[model samples]
Target: MVPASTSDPVPAPSPRPQQEDRDRSSRRRQRSAVILSAACWVSVVAAVVVFLGSGKPAQVTDVAGAITAAGIVTGLVGTDLLLLMLVLAARIPWVDRTFGPDVTMNLHRRLGKPAVYLILGHGALLTVGYSLRDGLSLWHQTLSIYSGGDMLLALLGSCLLVLVVVTSLVAVRRALAYEAWHAIHLVSYAAILVALPHQFSAGRVLAETSPQGVYWICLHIFAFGSIAWFRVAAPLFATDAHQLRVARVETLGPDVFSIHLSGRDLSRLHVRGGQYAIWRFWSRGTWWHAHPISFSAVPTDTGIRVTVRASGAGTRRLAGLRPGTRVSFAGPYGVFTAATRTAPRLAIVAGGIGITPVRALLEDRDLGPGETTVILRATDRSHAFLWDEVRALVRAQGGTVIEMLGGRAAGAPSWMSAAAAHGQATIHSLLPDLHASDLFVCGPAAWTRLVVHDARAAGLPDGRIHVENFTG
Candidate 1:
């Protein structure tokens, strides 16, 4: 059963829980993000410091030396950026908690091109420097570098890096299936492995005895170790701990269903309401694809539920899942939970299939009577996946549930329904206390943005608005 029900009204609280608790969690997340962001910048500055302290700048007496020094600095900064990318993509719980999964992955993607450019600059600068040093052509110098020491492996690593970056480009990425794209992305790990040996063998600056060398070695250890632990080992441990399997599947509407998962010690997953997990069902048709789906209901010790829409081939196969089909997941990720609350009241806006996480949020026990308001938008009654459950929960909590049904009205705010738009309804009109409440928006990307724009236009602080778009 869902955590909240119409049959059981929430017991009224005395003046609500102290607002300080909510403020404390918000401050903690902000502090954590600041500390983590500072550390990244410090690491980059230290890399440049290490390069400068090597006396390389003083040694740059000629054009060749200047180019060589430039190459080394670029290489150092580039490597630091690449490692930062890995750590962001590692899905470390602390990082995810601080930055949210969407922000973290977005940062990861943003760094890819610059990291590639810097690495390429390192190679190009080094090539020109060496060519000038030996009075050889760029081609001959390139051949010489490739033939010497660990340069061959470095060259191979560069090629792999290029491939990974190219495949990640939006145009290229969209052309390929997720499985194919993911397979190529995994090659980045191999690239890092192949690229690493060259650092010590080809450059003395990172020799084991130096302070710079020790710093870099530890950084590499931390970066790769985080990926191994959080991305690989942690998920494996969660899978083993829960041993999750499909207990049942209930059809909610056309193309929409809820997968009920049964597992051992499920509460150990520490899932927060409004968070999602990347699920991989161990079935012939669905095993190869992993989906990020929000929890439809909060978890108990033995069970959890995730709602899914058959929008693609991978998700369509979820309809055929049998009871006891093995399931493994890698989350409880995202920060769209009660812990993010920054205000005395909670306001939620969800559209179409986006209601899943909102359903889970409304079930949260901390939400007291008269402290929650939900606006669920859909084109029609059928499109409103779990509105009834949401309305029931809201009613029990002594809150409000507003339904917006119909397609968009022409020349109206894109996020609003025809009637609501025509009535001149806005976020402020619908949510009078928006400025004094934490607004959580979940829906299709464009529509979510429009809702967010309306909230912002209504003078809501950015920090007071939390969003989870359906698209990556």
Candidate 2:
């Protein structure tokens, strides 16, 4: 009798707690948005009431004129703040290791452009209005005393707006580097802090005469304060107290290395396969700086393993590190997990060093069987990182590994035909019927774009193709 296969049947993927957390957070943001939007309309109505009630001509000195100006400026700024908060809450990391960085980053770009426009309007109107009211120069006018500390508060608000715009631009951001850009963006909290004083002190609607105005003001404070506490403070407090210490380090290839880190309560760490953590080596002496890296090894009884390929300054340092080094991690963040959808067949495609996340998925006992396929495309055979390990894992899982050696892999037409052939022995061949399958592709921006385009040309549905790019 044929020996019973020792390999366990592939387990069904489970729901990720992080996705649930994100859903909950999205609901809260929607509710907040509704309330804020209603309050904005209410403020508009109040401004109209103040304007119609006044019999005086619409001169700059008139109370109606001032009220109208203030209302427009406040509404613009408040709305922008609400939108930005909602975007930030969605938590799209440009180069997120999990969730195939491409999708998340595209959404971020779409939202960012509108936010910049709103911020510009808020700054321009307020500056001109103040300059006209006070007889001083534009800069000096913002400094002049107003009935309720509005001018001083406005000045501080302007400073924050300047910082946000400067750091958000791509050119300035690249020069500052990722670490520096993140640090500068943190000042957004300070901007919100300064704006609060101006809103409370100068807001005419918030005065005792308008009870509804006070309600709106209170709502803004509650929404902003809650976001700050949860997004910033909670993470700092909740991470493990005893940082991870590197137990072992091994260079697998020219640029690839496996780093094993162990710390207290390793089992309870609750990190998922295909997810990444932000690592900060203590030797760097900069706790604020951290780089996102994919977890390489399957979580074992001892510790966690992250595979790194030297790419930049921070990663180069990591590749050179010895064993027994201590490091701090901020997360097990990213939505790139097997739990997102269910399918009869799964295909994983990785280009260059993008194989890191795919490797983790291969190790998962939950994703094996004849239903899965792992495809890796590298520039050349010599540059094919993780070739041996990937091949072994694929065979063990009853899956196939497709390695396409670019540049010189025989004639183009023949090579393409061979790579697309179907059989048990020809692992590089593409599966013919791929309509109902799920495909996960991760790589540099250009490679991911090409793969996605080809997959679509091959009759793959848009929903079935998930592309993750690290560059964006």
Candidate 3:
């Protein structure tokens, strides 16, 4: 029942419905984005105001003094950027919904280097400035600063911060285990705590009685509170109430396995299809590696399943887990579900094991017959992990399915097979209603981008296309 045929004349659209519903949702997202961006920038501006207005802006009478004044400025701004970085990583649901987790993580990485550099420059410039004012050598000034209040702990914190950042760089991270990297990154919390004493005790602008000081203190509280509540307290509460556990594990295909989890009060979970959760398995060897997997089917009152391809070492450990292995989860996150649908028609493209979310969506969404089409891609027939399920659903809904096999053409900048490329098959070729349909593409990021490129080339509006890369 692999109804693998879509080579036919296209059907015409029936009378259209109003675009108000889609437009309204899109507008709300736009407004939310604007508000979040403006708030972040506003914090930066307020930090500058507090610094300049705290006292008569220090007049630099000499080069050494000028360097010192600049150092102060950098210190204020660097701390501001660091605070922003903390907020980005706090996993706040509102922030995640507004800008997306991927976009927020990208911003976190982008701000890291510059924030650290500014802090470094602040340290260097102040060392020179203070040394000149005191008629002491650089080494003597450094020793003197370390001897005075909280500087030693700050120095140690800075070293740990540097280590965290260096290990997080893309090249260095590839060599480290996810668990190891995460352990190292946790040191960032200690670094931030230790670095705080010197800022409050040493810096002139953040003196305890000052307005700037109050604002800065509030910023720290808000940042720490967001992380503690969302990443810690909320998960703890949810796990206690739900009592989630592994019910069974089934082999789905070659090297693929599905973990069926059962829990209580799942309706309170507020989950949707096509969304994923971060699953932490409480097994002897696998307790530390939290796996991100999407639902293969929409959850029931007490049951859910997450399908995984056991390629990585961490994933391979899943098979040995005994029934009733306790499970803790963080979310039913991601915006690639029905909420992203902007049209009445649906066209989905999924590759390899990327079919997980798409399969869930197919089952969850209310698509009329002939209102959807799907293109499933795999390296071969066996790799098409859920093709039968897809075939059954698409056929039941009167939607067409096209199964693409084999690798891309030699030296070709395409995501399709050699045969399809030769036949001039494009997104529009497989999906004749491409312009009117909401297109969902899930795969490796690079291959997903190529599909998006094809859609864009055919002049499809960006809003009509949705992309999901399984980044958890």
Which model scores highest in lDDT?
1
lDDT of each: 0.86, 0.59, 0.82
RMSD, every candidate, angstroms: 3.6, 7.8, 2.6
lDDT of 3 by residue, 286-384 (tens): 988888788988888898889998867889899877899999988867777876677778899998778999999998876665777889888787888
Error of 3 at 374 (Å): 1.5
The TM-score that candidate 3 achieves is 0.93
Candidate 1 or 2, higher TM-score?
1
Residue-wise C-alpha lDDT for candidate 1, range 1-472, written one tens digit per residue = 0111223333333455557888888889999999998998999999999778766699889999999989988888988899998999999989999989999999888888888889999999999999999999999999999985688888898899899999998999999998999999999889878888888788754566677888898889999999999888989998998889999999999899999999989888888889999899999999989899999899999999999988888999999999999998898899998888888888899998899999998886456777777888888888888888898888877887777888888874578887777676777778776777899999888999999998888899999999999952
Lowest lDDT 10-residue stretch of candidate 3: 1-10
User: What TM-score fits each model?
Assistant: 0.95, 0.72, 0.93
lDDT of 2 at 465: 72
Clashing pairs in 3: none
lDDT, residue 375, model 3:
91
